[model samples]
Target: MAGLAALGAFAQAAPMVTSLGPVRAAVFPRLTGLGRPGHVALTFDDGPDPASTPRFLDALDEAGVRATFFLLGRMVQRAPALARRISDAGHEVALHGWGHRAHIALTPAQTLRDLRQGRDEVASATGRAPYWYRPPYGVATAATFSACRKLGLRPVLWSAWGRDWTATATPESVFHTVARDLRGGGTILLHDSDCTSKPESWRSTLGALPLLLEHCAEQGWKAGPLREHGIADADAEIGS
Candidate 1:
């Protein structure tokens, strides 16, 4: 009976993972990280890498921009000081779980445990509790939402992605990929680390940063971290 109940819960959540495309974005804007008009949210995932993250940080600093970095706990543990540097440099630090595993692959108990452990690890390294969560591969389950509620974390996914994880991705390709779907009030996803991607893929992402910011500036849009993207009010209304 206990096994059956867990299976039922998993069954109910499995479809959401596969169905979170344009329709889901249109129906659940807040969950897709949509926010205020004339503003764009900048975010990265699977990072705090010692070699590459610093370069991304330097690029953002030079551009006078900040972004939210969704960090993996194992990565944070390996580079705690770099994690501290991320917060100290004024970017937002958010949880990306203990490992880069999809919630759909974990049972409800496993999902909660991963989130809690990652949240604590991030808080310990950054000295600030993370307010947002982005699951690996942008896949969320019913367990993901429930665990976020229990841990006081809000789930957010990107509206536009650079597809910068590929070996074939170039700076121009990254920019154009994001530009194809990016609009004001959209969230842009890129990677600052290549831990889960092709080696040195972050270089393409780093190169595309200037182009993305320049494009946003040309459109009279303010691009910054999620905190400044105005998600709180939208989330409040949607979650209610």
Candidate 2:
């Protein structure tokens, strides 16, 4: 069954290793300059929806690509089967809070509760806790980072974003944003589920995926998990 496969993959991914240590530093991907061979990480947020998630998965399958998904805990509870599909397909699943609330507005205790609930729901659905946490709308506070460290999740923010959460954003616009902003070691943010809108804002994302993947191939850019690059070390801060 799909659930068994997901469990097997989770074991292979070794989520327990991620939980073993406290995070010292969080490093996002460094941007690469033009004409240089680079790497990009593709990430999605706010989903596992029935309508849009399947389409996104089909596109990723067609492209032979993988991505990280920061899934909302409440949504996972609503669509546990779809969450299993995401895990079974070999994508990284991370936390995106319980209801997509802004972290800056919540007390540290409240933030911890939301993160704990989100991680628990995701792990329950997929059989492994996530190692990354992306705050809703890229809004983070000192409290958010503290909570992340306490929960054994690293705070992951994108180096570039497609702003695909907008209902009016066209596929072409999404493509342009990604292609124009891409750099080596950059994290590109896209959405597979849009809980913020009435019908959800994933149509543009679905339409933009193939073009983005093709462009990455043309540019010789590789894509992988966010943690694969490792956290930014003390040296990077000194150099920067």
Residues 1-240 of candidate 2 have per-residue lDDT tens digits of 332233224324543312211121122222111112366778888887887899988888888888888899999999999998998999888889888877656778998999999999999999979987887866655566567667888666666667687767888898898777676666778888767753656888788888888888888887765655444531232121
- Candidate 1: tens digits of C-alpha lDDT, residues 8-33: 35436664442355755675678788
Whole-model Cα lDDT of every candidate shown, in order: 0.86, 0.71
The runs of at least 3 residues in candidate 2 whose Cα sits more than 4 Å from the true structure, single-residue gaps closed, are 1-37, 198-200, 229-240
* Cα RMSD (angstroms) for every candidate in the order listed: 4.1, 11.1
Q: What ranges in model 1 sit over 4 Å off?
A: 1-20, 232-240
The estimated TM-scores of all candidates read 0.91, 0.80
